[model samples]
Target: MTRPQLTYRSWATALAALVTAAATALIGPAAPAQAAAVTFTNPLAEQRADPHVYRHTDGYYYLTATVPEYDRIVLRRATTLQGLATATERVIWRRHGSGEMGAHIWAPEIHFIDGRWYVYFAAGRTEDIWAIRPYVLESSAANPLDGPWVERGQLQPARSSFSLDATTFVHNGVRYLAWAEYAGSNSNIYLARAVNPWTYTGTPALIATPTYAWETRGYRVNEGPAVLIRNGRVFMTYSASATDASYAVGLLTAAAGSDLLNPASWSKRATPVLASDGRTGQWGPGHNSFTVAEDGSDVIVYHSRNYERYLGNGYDPLSDPNRRTRIQRVYWNADGTPNFGVPVPDGLTPVRLRSHDLPDRYLRHWEFRARLEPNVTNLADSQFRIVAGLSNASAISLESTNYPGYYLRHRNHQVWVERSDGSALFRQDATFTRRAGLADATKVSLESVNFPGQYVRHRDGLLYLEAVPDAAGRASATFALD
Candidate 1:
């Protein structure tokens, strides 16, 4: 015990321990790993309606939408989704002078089919502008922007009556086309199998109609069908009501392997998946297309008017040029269905906080009380902006996205999103110092600035400021800013 033998292994172990301790002492505790912030400005592009963002395998995002002029099919490509905002738009194909494809060029969705590029769009004649029909344009060029788009004529469904907003997808070795067509006096979504990009092989089946009260607002309408296949299910989102502020998004779902041409295969939701959020000043948020983000996360690309009123080109909502293109991340429910959430405000996008220990749960506010919940139906309740502290500039605060002026403040040790009464106590209660996660340094922990040793932790599904003195308590305090 007085004199230990200097073995090579023992000496190396002692030396390694001394080096680690010295390094730790020199730098204090290891700095926490900072997560890369993923954000994009709202209104991705101005005056772009029925926006479709397609991420190609060639590492480019191709964007095509309804131009305000309704005169041409324009295409823009960028490497990043955010870059699409400033990306140069090229009019790949223009309307015909007077015949078919002459007027009302709308909802141009770009898709790469087989080996050629295809643009499925709706157009009308100059003499009869209301005679809108879905059409297809093909290109042999590698880049659709630099295209010699050959008009493939109309993509004739089985019952093509004033058809528009056509979208195509292939599943189980079969390609199917989904579009909104006028059925009876109302516009309904129809589905059919496609032999080629321009032709349907079988009879088109009516999948969704404007029957619910939300679907029948200004008009008995259901149009703008967009297809997204995920989680063993085929999701079809279509726009309802008129093109005014009453326009919203409804969803129809079918089993992936089921007979898509059969009307019985699809089930429609009673309510819309996405609608206008007056709190965020977004109106008529409809005509959406889905795409994957750079990080391989699902993103919804849609058009919305920031203002509720239409003041451009008479009373027609379509005449208003302010229905700008926007995009946001799509969250998923426990059942694998998508939660589009509310149309977020026009600024930096908000983020969700996922519980570290309970991965399925998120920090959400219900009736103004902060708690952890899974599969939150109200998507806005789960979203928040991590901003500078209301009281201390050096700290941080969680601001509710839906309630602009409210923040997550600890009142009597319980967290709630309360309107700031402009009191010093309110600000102090809302402020929290961002610390390295007590359980996992890579994650984050919010410590109460007012109550130094207490941390914002989850207990019994509710959030509270409590002392994280144990491993379980530390785990509850940690959160992933997703």
Candidate 2:
């Protein structure tokens, strides 16, 4: 007999009912079911730049980006984040043949506001392709993809000159619009209070500009503003420099309840929060937006090219078609600031293993040697893919992110990441059974499959497979996966 495949909605409903029934029988009231974890490979979509992902309250995720053609606005939707990889894209609107909205359509961002859908984008005229300005479209349809969109004309935030990349956010019952426009020769980020989705009421304030050396490389630019509010603070991230390998993300912050229109309320970080990393092979990671995962963890969505050099005929950045959309988890620091780690290499999403006993230390490989270290400079070296074991499907193996074919294995009671030799002994030596932490039941411990009494533990800042029969040994073996 064959069984029907279960959809995510049906499976989640069944799981919630089972948890509720069990809780009511044992305790007084039913408890809420926990959400399943989400993971996806790098380069979520190809030939997509300035990516924006918005999670709606109707149980779906909507995505839009700057397509290489720069002639139409497209949108896609999926129930799961990874499902957006192969989701069918629909073009909602196209550029005009001539006149105002006739050429160079770019950086379209979709937003749901006040029970309606709005799309803000930039375009140039037919006669002059470089005379770019921001524009808007409105739709009352419940689904944005199936829209009879009405053009609202150009958005004049101020005396606009070479303006683009418009993004909007609401705070304290008032909406605000932010975008990048030229003040003389320097492109700077500006903000203003919005009277409606497409119009602003007050003079735009200059929030950020290209001043530092990193922001002024190639060309002085500060564009693509995205906002995230959390922990009594508002974080505004914008891209800087030219749209090449020098492009990076800088941050501006202010108190959640403070006056957002005042330029003095915002503080700029001296260095970039996210940029190119040679170790991960991701170049020019910028123009980022934020969304929440299935498990309620914060996720950052951005675009980056795998290679540093332009693969097109000329040096024009617009000619490159490899700026693919990518997503990664956003980690928070102890002081409540966000830590956007380096762009992870292509593969299954990696996780960081934090030592339970020493909270600051994490499992990492240095020069192919396994050790527990703090403040690791190369974040890719500390990331690993916990996959099914090579020997047994029931066990697990830790695969290095940077070194694709390498895994953590124990030889003569010492743990090191080595290339698999594909032998039965090597498989068993690499595989481990995950068990409840012996020191803290809430955490996890890795027990050696071949050596029943031994576990992967840290001693003298190095990793080793040893017997964990004592309390100190158990503490050293426990870890918290992030």
Candidate 3:
């Protein structure tokens, strides 16, 4: 309800034009034009990881994502539902001591109960970063900006040794928590009634398991569970297989009156609900959380390894930060089930991509607060279009802007804190930097020539293209820009 206020600016002008063209297209990503997007607020950015957006009573939207470092929980609040995607963030909880939470704290969610705020997340024991489980912390303050978060302890279900990805939902007046855990033989998804919000009731129930050939990718995994109730039906969606590879998502359903504990009452859908678009080369596209669009549309936010398999095998860059986050809309199939098909075709927008009904923030950038000083021109004062080049910058140089002092900037992808003289190594806290290859200058254009049907804005910015699919590195858009 308390969404941020944003006014239209010049940066988003061209995007306003594209939306008109996008409206008249006869395709899935393309759609009939409705109303022009009026910029509101958006919070998710290039660095926020493992994002989970939650809607609360005050009408304000709250979001928390796993920082790439896996050490702290980053929280952002915005007035409008979509604004949370672009708002400034604050680190709410941090690791203390050495074991469990001291390292690898991930997937934190901020929830409001009775007047107080609480956040639930999973972290590994200090000694071993892999011995991870869910833990809760509470805040007494009205806003999460500043709070004394008291540790509420862990919610480990009985019998199951390994577990994580916990979330709570209130259905028909009863509140229950659902999560994914492995019980020795198989890594599957499960559900349980929360005695309260932080603990489970009785025994846990199995909602889904990895029985299919496709569900098992990196490891026998079925995790990241989010429960949804629509038109009197109970549904649970869980991420499947390894944290890497073509990460997939699956769904399970239970009738209104059926016992949630009865696996018989719940039936797993035969096919995967979400997966990677091989053509886009963005693999392992699972681990998702749902949020409502400004106009009540469903938005799916998940992370993916932008480039090919870069990590998990010693010194691979893929494991470090290349595993960026991405998002797309989820539509309903004729049967009424949420149809989260594969992602958009990399560069070009999805054929029928539902604009989050967000303000004009999409297809635009306006964060540049520093005034552009008029530079000495090489071409006698000609005005140039500030276009997105081989990466993600919205830069304007007088053609002479190519030089160090008159450099182009993509704020999101800019490597913060680089060496003063533009060396490879620099401090970590720096805010902006000149994009790579800006000096080398590769042509930035529509990627239609590279992949045909799909068109990409090969802008000049920090897009860590993939190496696995071999050709995936060229002419595509990834979350590094998201």
Alpha-carbon shift of residue 450 in model 2 (angstroms): 4.8
Q: In order, what lDDT does every prediction score?
A: 0.84, 0.83, 0.53
User: Candidate 2, overall lDDT?
Assistant: 0.83
Error of 2 at 154 (Å): 1.5
Worst lDDT run of 10 residues, candidate 2, spans 27-36
Candidate 1 lDDT (Cα, whole model)?
0.84
User: What does candidate 3's lDDT look like per residue over 1-482, in tens digits?
Assistant: 12331233222333433543332231113112332121211113444556677777767778787776777887888876434544677878788677657867877877787678878888887788777778888888878877878888788443236667778777777777777666776777777787766778776888788887777755677788877677568877777766655467788888888888788998888777766555445666666777775556677777766545522656433245545445555555445667665553332223121112111111221132211111212111111112222222322111111111222222333311111334322111121212221111222212221222222222233221112232333323211111
Q: Which prediction has the highest TM-score against the true structure?
A: 1
TM-score, cand. 2 vs. native: 0.84
Q: Which candidate do you rate higher for TM-score, 2 or 3?
A: 2
Off by over 4 Å in 3: 1-44, 156-160, 310-318, 345-482
**1 against 2, candidate with superior TM-score:** 1
Error of 2 at 270 (Å): 2.0
